[model samples]
Target: MTSLRHNMAYLLTITILIVSVGRLGDTTGRRRLLLIGILLFTLACILCGLAPTLWTLIAARALQGLGAAIMMALTMAFVGETVPRARIGSAMGLLGTMSAIGTALGPSLGGALITGFGWPAIFLVNAPLGVLTFALAYRNLPADSSGEKTDRAGFDIAGTLLLALTLSAYALAMTIGHGRFGPLNVALLLAAAVGTGLFVFVEARTASPLIRLAAFRNPVMSASLAMNALVSTVMMATLVVAPFYLSRALGLDQALVGIVMSIGPVISTLSGVPAGRLVDRLGAPFVIIVGLAAMAAGSIALTVFPGIAGYVAAIAILTPGYQLFQAANNTTVMMDVRPQQRGVISGMLNLSRNLGLITGASVMGAVFALASAASDIAMARPEAVASGMRTTFAVAAALIAAALAIAAQTYRRRRAADPR
Candidate 1:
């Protein structure tokens, strides 16, 4: 229960702070915030390790999330700012590859550490690593952001608070939705809707809104964000459901399932740079379309076959689809916006991801539960669960198709306007 609380706290804080901290990096300096975030993350790890109570751990996790938000948002903004427009996709791809490696390694590493030294070691391990990263960043990076400083005429505190409330409510709804629907979930979901409406209303009025509404005025950027959200939904849903399908329906051992699942990340990590090269050469629209096509094909393939070979093929293909789509889409969005607004644009990208993740998990989980007639997915019959999995993949494919349509329209409009 405490572990779940900590996870929720981290997720909520991290998603909400990305915008605020990204804006701060735009105003103050990416270098300062980047180093500060790393230092704070390291210190928070130590605090988490030494904490005596569950509440203490939860609070520390929340703080750690703040640091992570600052680091993630600003780091991406920095890369977008520093890299040439032509090469930003490649740079983003490399960054994604490194992230995949770390994510893939974390669970295995944490398990080993917990067995040997305790849960504290899971966090203690970050301290030395964070120190190394901090040193490298300080020694190699410049002192100031490439973009101009944002005017501090107003800080949009109200807007930030509303945005935070909105995200928190949405996350809470998802968390509570894990069990049967009740008043609490309904209330939180209502609060989320209200908060969202209020955020848009307030942002349109505020001078220093966290996100500039004008940023989305560009068809390309807006379409890119939409694609990002849809693609992420499919990606996350597949991620959550596949293990159940593998272990239960396919009768694979946990070890074999893990290895099978690892194929996606490994393939994604390997293909990142190559996908970037394609994006640079062919342009983001072409790359994005190709990615969407690959994902759609993979979804269809899995729905039809739903066996070991099918799973492997789907992972191999869909992983690159996700990687390519993300890299190209990030490049597309950043390219359309002004350099000064890149921080917030980057934040919006991360925000879209968070929304997709939470929605995908909750929505797809509900579908699986309803279809299987079981509260716990693990307890569902293999054939029933397989049927649910097929339905889920079909939905994912439909989403990709929708995104591709939007992307195609945006591409057509852009090409017609530019005529370059």
Candidate 2:
């Protein structure tokens, strides 16, 4: 429960702080914010390592997430400003590859460190890396002139808080709804509704709203956001379900399971740069179609054969699809928005992804639970859980197919209108 709290603290805060932090970066200067964030993150890691209690660790983790959110939002925004408009896709693609490599390495490295030198090693190692990143950014990153001036509308404090409440409530509702529907869950959902209403009212009046209401007006941009959310649903579900299916259903040990699980991110890493290049050359819409098809195919493959070979192959196919879709999607969103709106758009991108994660956790959990209850394998049994996995994969495949169809229609509509 303690570890869960710590992890949840990190996850929840990332979504909450990302938008405001991202917008703050845009106005305050990305470099300065990035450096401050690194400092805070490094300090928070040390605090997490030395914390005397679970609550202390959780607090530190939340701070760490804030720092991470600041950096992540700015990083994308920064890349947009640094690169040429024509090459942004390629640049973002390289960034995505590096991100994939880190994601692929983190679990394995953390496990090894924890086993060898205790858990403190995990946090301690980041200190030096953080310092190096700080140094690099200070020396090499472009100077920002926006440091002195502030947005004319000023920070919408009430709006920011309300938006955070809205996001927090939604996350809590999904999380609590996982096990059972209780008073707390209902209250959370109510809070979410009230928070959203308050946020809309606040944004309507605020000069510098956290999110511009007009951003959703573009059909392509709106669909891109929705596509990101749904695609992330598939990604998160696969990550959550595949391991259990491998370890329990296939009877693989932790080591072997980890190996199999590594396949997707590994493929993602290798494919990320190439996928980005493809996005640059082929356009995001074309690459997205290809990616969606691959993703749906992989999910269907998992449904057909949940064995070791099939599992790895499914991940391998799905990985590049994920890489392709994500890289292209980021490029598309950034390209769709104006330069000044980059930071906020990136924030929205992260928000959409995280919402998908929370949603996937709740929806997939419910689906699996219900499927397990209805399966012939018997409830509370491993086979029953595996039965749930089978059902979820099929469901995921169908969802991806629907997304594919939507993307196709949108792209076709655009092409027909433009003839380009």
Candidate 3:
């Protein structure tokens, strides 16, 4: 899970950058960049499959992240530009559903492939899919004609460096915390804090910021971003700790753990389409608030119960909310921004979610560490772990509640601003 998270962190970062860059490219050149990104992603997958060591794999993953970022950014921008405003809600819902499906299936598929073959199969599977996607994207996507040149002056290297440094430092802290870092961990944490502060400062000052600070002028966008980050944090925390609780606390075997874990994604897939449809009729704000409320309820339930059955039930309850929130939020953010800025906006949103995930995971790990320290796992047994997990869940629930409040404010503000 740690390895996957690390890879995804880079992947998401790169995907955002490439796509945003592609968006700025000459309108006619955007499709070409998308194609190139697809090709690079495919090649990166091959490289990842053949990687000889962990370091090599990480490098390959970084390359793949770049490709994925490009595709995601450009695709989001394209949807905003090509789809009509009225239909965009539906389109975003569909897109969100598809993403949910991929996420849902990914674990099961990867597990099966790993069981049947080896870890390499996990990546090799993407080779064929990538080829098929490229072929279709090339044949179907129209050539861009927006006539916008790549904004050479728009790239904020200082901001990008600061952002990357902050994320990397956080990732390092999480990955290395399990070891006997002692006081070194404190130093790293401090460094991360300093880096984050610098990033905020640089972003505020950069002439053409990588992430448009001006976007926050829109209350809806600002609130939505905040809500997205918190929601992501809660979701990631649950994802990280749930399996541990099931396998360690409940004494479930690996197979049962997998089965129990499938519940959330299954529910998410089932709910995504319906949520999307609801968003279209009710608007994204309404859907998002409902989703956040559901997630909060689910997380709280998990915290209170701390039993296998309860956890499963909580996941079932929580999954739909998350799916809905994702679908609605995507639509809300994309529609809120102008067509030309969609790529950068999309990148920023993705970055927010990724950063949230990293932060959540690190904090949860700390929770686990503190819990384990309080009671020796071997002596106190799984109850101590359960206690720790419960605390984490409670924190997650609180964060989700905060997200719900933000979502409510966003909706109210947007409605007031556009009182049509």
Question: Candidate 1: lDDT over CA atoms?
Answer: 0.84
Error of 3 at 154 (Å): 4.4
Best by lDDT: 1
- Flag the better candidate by TM-score, 1 or 2: 1
Error of 3 at 394 (Å): 1.4
Error of model 2, residue 157, in angstroms: 1.3
Give the per-residue lDDT of model 1 (tens digit) for 1-420. Answer: 878898888888888889888877777677888899999999999989998999999999998998899888888888876788889888888888898898688778887899999999998899999999999999987778444554554667888899888888877887685835689988988998999899889999987787777777878878877888898888888778889889888889998988888888788889888888888898988888898989998888778876899889877888898888888888888765666776777888888888888888887777666766676788888998888888888888998999999988988898899999
Q: Residue by residue across 374-420, what tens digits does model 3's lDDT show?
A: 54443435777788787887888889888887887767776888898
Preferred candidate (lDDT higher): 2 or 3? 2
Q: On a 0 to 100 scale, what is the lDDT of residue 344 in model 3?
A: 71
| Estimated TM-score for each candidate | 0.96, 0.94, 0.88
- In candidate 2, how many clashes are counted? 0
Compared with the true structure, the alpha-carbon lDDT of candidate 3 equals 0.75
In candidate 2 the C-alpha lDDT for residue 191 amounts to 90
Clashes of each: 0, 0, 6
